[model samples]
Target: MQAVITFRQFSFRYKNQSEPTLKNIHLEIARGEKIWIAGPSGSGKSTLAHCINGLIPFSYGGEMSGQLLLDGQDASGMTIFERSRRIGTILQNPDAQFVGQTVGEDVAFQLENEAAPYDVMKTAVSSALELVGMQAYEAQGPHELSGGQKQQVALAGVLSTQADILLFDEPLANLDPASGAKAMRLIDEIHRNQGKTVILIEHRVEDVLLEHIDRVVVMNEGEIAAIGTPDELLAAGILPRYGLRQPLYLEALSHAGLPLSGFTDLSHPESLKPTEDGSEPQGPPILSESQLRDRLEAWSTSVLPAGRGSLGEPLLELRGVSFAYEPGMNAVADVTLTVRSGETVALLGSNGAGKSTLSGLITGLHKPGSGEICLRGEVINGWSIRRRGEEIGYVMQHPHHMLTQHMVRDEIRIGLVARGVPEPEREQRTEEALQICGLYPYRNWPVSALSFGQKKRLSIAAILALQPKLMILDEPTAGQDYRHYTEFMEFINRLSGEGMAFLFITHDMHLALEYADRAAVMSEGRVIAEDAVARILADGGITSRANLRETSLARFARAQGLVSPSRFVEAFIAAEKKVKRA
Candidate 1:
């Protein structure tokens, strides 16, 4: 295969930044190959992706060295528009790239720019939308679509241009697990059929590896650490050291003390041939397929049981709440829920499922049409958003939206300073919040220096400084890799232990299963089921109805041929949590 994207001893330093974001990098990708780049939060993976599609030197004013080649040509002189003809970029936030209001207009924007004929542009737009299964939604507004749908429309725009090299930068970041999986499936199909060269920069490692990847490249601190086939890298057991997520199947095997060498392939779990039941068989000490499932089932049942002891008095309550932007159309309707003191409750549902609307009501950002909101038995429906902020801190879904200050410590201190906190105490609380959020080391650094995950922690720290009794976090762990995900959840779990309640509006099932005491599932503006996380996950009917999917561990257990998939799933998840907690 011919090299389509190449970087030779490349390095980049942002304006006024001492350290180069990408240092002495060298990477080459072949035409028609699908490669997944894996890295931790600040390892310069995004910078590398930006460099590939000619954004580093074009959009970002930066000092650079060495050569970058696209399609065997020197890309240093190419304009972003020139690069776009060969390379297409799909960003983490698809909404950022949306230029037109409607899907058809968005897809045809590029064709229109090229001055293509009306008939030619129409055919290209329709064909592109059809490829992503969005043909019927061409005339619909992009804002009217779900997060996943918006992403599909975004891809259609790129596809309409017929760009050969696709650069997807964390495309799954905003999608739910199931939706993420479907998006990956679509990308895989496009790659296979259209033969587009793909370089995907993502932290959803386990999910990305499910496709037929040509190679896997691992980057650490702006340098390529390793590159090889997926099987070689995954089975080699080096990902955990670099803060990258391993396939959950491998994690389960490790947890079970099963020798990983026994497997011929980890990707295709159906092709697995396990060891015998007892004695030293082909892979002894390792359970058979059925035995593996049984072991997982046992662990699942033993994990957190159906019901926790008793929760505290209701801290926040909603009764028959309904809201709408326009008459006769309710965004949130007849919703009733409660969050008790010192308990973490997960609010889960599909995109466009009124989760955000309900949260707006609680924060006093929106007025309830029919129902009342109470905080500690006192009606707070009439409260101002500022008044509610004193009692209930809200961390918006996008960290950048909440982050306003230029410096790290100042960002966290904003809340304290806003409410006239004393200088001495403000400094004291900001330091404590930074330490807890793991941003102490970067206290004096510019807010732009932080990673997406760090920015998220900064958002939390800002809210934590307010000393609110309750907090609402939306997709708190969306962009985090496994290591930070575990650390942040543990931090939140600890905070919840100290009388602070939380309502987590998230799509991460792992976070919900391990951190939340109970889960309230929402669908189409109604709370359908309220139960323990274990119960919610164990019941397939509720999961499917709520448009949620099982964790990879649960899927692994089922794939291993466990007798009872649900029980095994629960047990396996419990065991993993127990191990992590220990």
Candidate 2:
């Protein structure tokens, strides 16, 4: 097969940076092949994608060395418009790409730009929308759609362009597990049926590998660290060594002393078994079913369950609160919940399930139509946004919405200054927050220079400096890598221990499972389930209705026919907590 994209000793340095973002790179992606590029934040994955999609020289001025070729032609001189004719990019944030009011209009924008005939544009738009299962929503405005729906509209826009190569940057970062799985299936269909070259730039490596991938290219710093098939990398145990996490089941196997090299197919847990047809095994089987069961049982029993700490007094409360964007449609309906001091609560649900709206109601951004909101046993439904700000802090799902200051240090200290905090105390809090978020070195840098993940940390740091009684974070870990996510969560854990309350509205199941003490699941603007985090995750019925998927440990237990799979999950979590403490 001929190479559709080539990088020959390519290196690039931004005009504002002292070091090259990409260095001494060499790569070739064949036509019609599907490849995944993964790494931690600031690892040059985005820089490589920008180079391939014609953003490096055209939109972002930079110093470039060596050559990048598109379809056998040098690409250094290609304009973004010229590149768009052959390559289409779907950005991490779909809202940033919308140029039209409705779904149909957005999908037709590219066609209208090319001056295609009315009938031609209509046919192409309809076909693309149907392909993404968004045909029924063609008349809906952008604001009326959910996060996953907006992503589909963005993809429809790209598909209508009929570009030979499609690039997706962090497509799953903002979606729930079910929606992420659906998006992957759609991408796979497009790759197989249309023979388009597919390139995915994502930090969620495990989610990306749920679909088929021809190659996994792992990058670290500014250089390529490893490039091979997914199985090869998993067998070699190279991902964790380079700050990336493998699939959860594989990690569980490792914890159990089962060598990953013995597994031929690591994609599915059930694939670990020998073939039933008695054919030659692809790889050596480490143990029979009985032996595996015995080992799992012994390991699980040896690990004692951890105890939950006592929670402090109620810090915030909501009682039968209801609100509607319009007269007849309630976005938040009859919701009642509580957050206690020194406790961490997870609010989980599918897109359009009113999680963010509930947070807004608590933060005084929206007035409740009914019921009361209370703080420390006093009703606070009449509190002003600023008055509520003194006790509660909110970090929005998108960091750009929360950031106002130009420089990193100013952004962190602005709230404290507005609240009339003393200069010395403000400086101390700001410095402490910057250090906690690993943003100390970038304090003097412009906010625009930071990546999405860095901006997220900055947003959280700003909120942390306020020292509010309660904090509400929406999708806090969306763009972060594993290492930073752990460090940030550990910091949050310490704050909770000191008597601060937290409410997290997130789509990352792993984040909820590992951190939250309690979980409240919502559906159709109503709280449908509330319980301990482990119990909530163990219930398949609740997870299904809430559009959440089971954790890998739960799936692994079921696959191995464990007598009490939920207990197995709880035990694993307990063991993990014990290890973290040690």
Candidate 3:
């Protein structure tokens, strides 16, 4: 196979940094090969991607050496625009890259950049949009679209460029289960039909492996740790040590105490069947309800602290709230909800189901047209977003939007400084927040030098400095490596115990099941259901309707005729807790 991307002793160190983000790398990616790159948050995955896209030394000033070749040409000397024409990149934050107001214009912008004819651009845009199932949203503004929808539009824009090499950064970070599966299919189709080379930087390993990938390249702290085929790497348990996700199916099987030797492919649930060499049953064993229940109950008892205990008094309340950007098109409609002190509630729904809009309403970005929002029993409709922040804080999905300062310590100290706090108090709060977020060591580092995950931590630290009674964390775990994800959740759990209320808005069903005290589901701008997370996962009717999904363990339990969904979920969660979520 001809090499499309070649790295020879490549290394990069950002200005003012002590060490290189990428160090002494040597890698080769052949044409028409699809590879999934797995790594911890700051393990040089994104830095490597930047190298291929001509952003490292070009846009981000850095000390660089060695050589990176793309299509037999050196990538170092090429202009960003020239490299962009050959390598299309869909970044983690789709909104940041969108240049056009509407979907059609966004998709066509790439073609326009290429100076293609109007007719040719139009045809390419339509085909690209249709490929991503966003053809009907041609006139919708990117801001009006949901996070998942915006990501899809971004994918369409990249496709329109007709670049044979595509680089996707955390493509499924914001998508629901169904949308993510569809995206996998779309990318697979492009790889197969167009014969393009694809390099995907993703944390959702299990999901990406649904399509056929030629190899997996695992990175650890600026170095390649391992590279192998899916079966070889997964079966060898390569993900646990690196702060990455393991295949959900394998986790499910382990929880059930079943031997994994029977399975052929752990990546795809549909492909998970017994071996043909007469080793075990041809499929999942049917577990009885009582048997499954016992297993789950034992697991739960082992993992959960004596109990969820009594929840604290109500800290925040919403009464019949309705809001709209444009009259007669209500984005959040008549939804009444509450959050009690010492509770972490997972707010879940589809991409366009009004979760973000509801967050906006709660944060006072959009005033309610009908009902009232109360903080600690006081109506707060007149409060400004900043005024509300004194008692209520919000951390957005993308942390970059919340980060403005140049240094880590300064970023955390901004809120306290703006409130005219004494320097002593401000410094105290900043140090406390950084310590809680495990960012104390990086306090002196420039904010721009932090990786995406580190930036997210910085964002959280900024919010924590306020000491709000309640915090709404919107997809706080998106870009986190496993270590940070677990530690952050533990921190939240500790805070919840100390009487801080939390509303967790996220698409990760596993996170919801593992951490949420309760699951509040929204559908078409209404609170359709709210229940314990385990019960919510068990309720197929609600999950399917609202686009919330059952965990693989729950689904596996359902596959067994006698086992119940809730029972399997209990056992799975217990297993996770026993392992402290690996």
Candidate 4:
């Protein structure tokens, strides 16, 4: 195990920054090793990756100190191209990296830039696509692919460069559960068969742990906090302390008064076992195995059925709606749904499953080819996008897309000013929106200075100023950390409690489980099922068909031979809510 990357007391400060983004970092990554660099947002994980990929002092023009060695050579002397020749970076958004219309052409772009011959470029493109198992999609347009296919194409483009080290930044941020698991498998295959070093910086720790990782490097405030095997880190109980989430099953074990210290391997729920001799657990005077089971059963069976009160009047409804971007292919077809006042509903499916298309029809961005869209029991199919904005505020997945004004205050006020609300009322609503979104302190700050999470809230504040009855949010918590996610989503819950209905188009199962009252699952342009969040997630048939994965808690229940895994899941959710309240 030779060190391919070494950082010896390395630190970097961006221009105009008072402190270094990375502070006295010392780390070593062995060649061909797969490691996860995980932390909450702004913990300096991305900055470390930038340094490795030669973006810090190259593209970003940062002040550097100490040494960064790549393959036993000084990185400071090497140009960006020199470093890029050994490290290929894959961004979070695959759509942002596409330069060619077709997958084959895109993968060949790097070879062409090197002035390689046509035959060489073609062979390289084929080899790369074949490695990612996407050769059949070589001639297809990038937009014609699903989210998983697009990610594969992105990986293929990187592989064509023949870089030995693959750096993935938030690779699973925008993908559904099934696609994300597949992505992890592909990365693992590349690591095993290709013997390439894989460095993944992501917020989705649970998803990345699906494959075997050589080590976990936890970063906090631009410093390496800890580095160890997954079992070691999970046993340390530091992930949640630093605003990152532990796997749901691990959290459940702790909540149930089961000591994790007794188990040497805590990475997977299936690994939990009783002691060889009939004895209580170590490191704490906890319950015996049988007592633990009895305690769990008592707590679980005592939970009341999970449901909400009577629903308010219907706010929005789609009756047999259908739409298509091209002829003879419906993006959304024969779908029907309803959102009542004050309810939070999640629109869920794999990419290309028609979730976003249905939202477009509801918001008047695209008219339905057939059927009716009713708002408050009245058909509003012919309404303009502007008119629909009056009652339905749509938040795009990327917050930057919705931001226009330079300052947060102006961004929230611009929409109100355009709608001709009275000056006094507009002022009041703008302040209310800012306060509601927790953006009042940053109201005068430049939009560019806000973090990704803050920008998301600002976008919501802008839409909130319109006083819309129904808010449609697409991937609302894409890049947010666990802390920011809880804060942001809990705020949304408060609003929902105050009678504002929300339609969440998301791939985040955790968000749906904790915040959403119900989930409407879509598959192949059709509404396959709509029911309680726990039930929808508990159904393996529906989850498999819709490209969703069962929650870890559910899997843990099944592994433990619980009577009703779905009910067990519901009971856990109920207990979590009660804990939050306390």
Model 2 over residues 150-261: C-alpha lDDT tens digits?
8899999999999999999999888987788788989999999999999998777667877899998989898999999988888898787777878877776666777776
Q: Which residue pairs show backbone clashes in model 1? A: 299-571, 300-570, 300-571
| Candidate 1 lDDT, 1-582, residue by residue in tens | 788888899899988888888888888898899998888888888888888887787877789998898878899888889999888899888888999989999999989999999999999999999999999998898978999999999999999999999999988888876788889999999999999998898887766866788898888888888898887887787677788867666776666667677665666554555534445454353545666666555554555634353678999999999999999998888988889999999999888888988888899888999988999999988889888988998998888888999999889877788899999999999998888777788899999878777898899889988889999998888778778777767877777878889999998886787788889999888899998776677577887887787666556655666655556545556667667667
Q: Which stretches of candidate 4 lie over 4 Å from their true place?
A: 274-295, 406-410, 420-454
Sort by lDDT, top down from the best: 2, 4, 3, 1
User: What is the TM-score of each predicted model, taking all chains together?
Assistant: 0.93, 0.97, 0.91, 0.93
User: Considering every candidate listed, which one attains the maximal lDDT?
Assistant: 2
lDDT of 1: 0.83
Which residues of candidate 2, in runs, are more than 4 Å off? 274-284
Predicted candidate 4 versus true structure: per-residue lDDT over 1-582, tens digit per residue: 899999999998877667887999999999999999988777888889989998877867768999999999999999988998899999877888899989999999888889999998999999999988999989899878877888899999999999999999888877999999999999999999989999998888779888899999998888888888998888888888787998887776666666677554567666565434325544443445566567667767888755685668999999999998999999999999999999999999998899988988999989999999999999999888888888999998778778998988999889888999999999899988888666787788788756566788788788878878999999988777788678767777878888899999999988898888999999999999999888888889999999999987787777676777788778878877877768
| C-alpha RMSD values across all candidates | 2.9, 2.0, 3.3, 2.8
Candidate 1 residue runs with Cα over 4 Å from true position? 268-310
Stronger candidate by lDDT (1 vs 4): 4
What is the Å distance of residue 47 in model 3 from its true position?
0.5
| TM-score, predicted candidate 1 vs. hidden true structure | 0.93
Query: Which pairs clash inside model 3?
Result: none
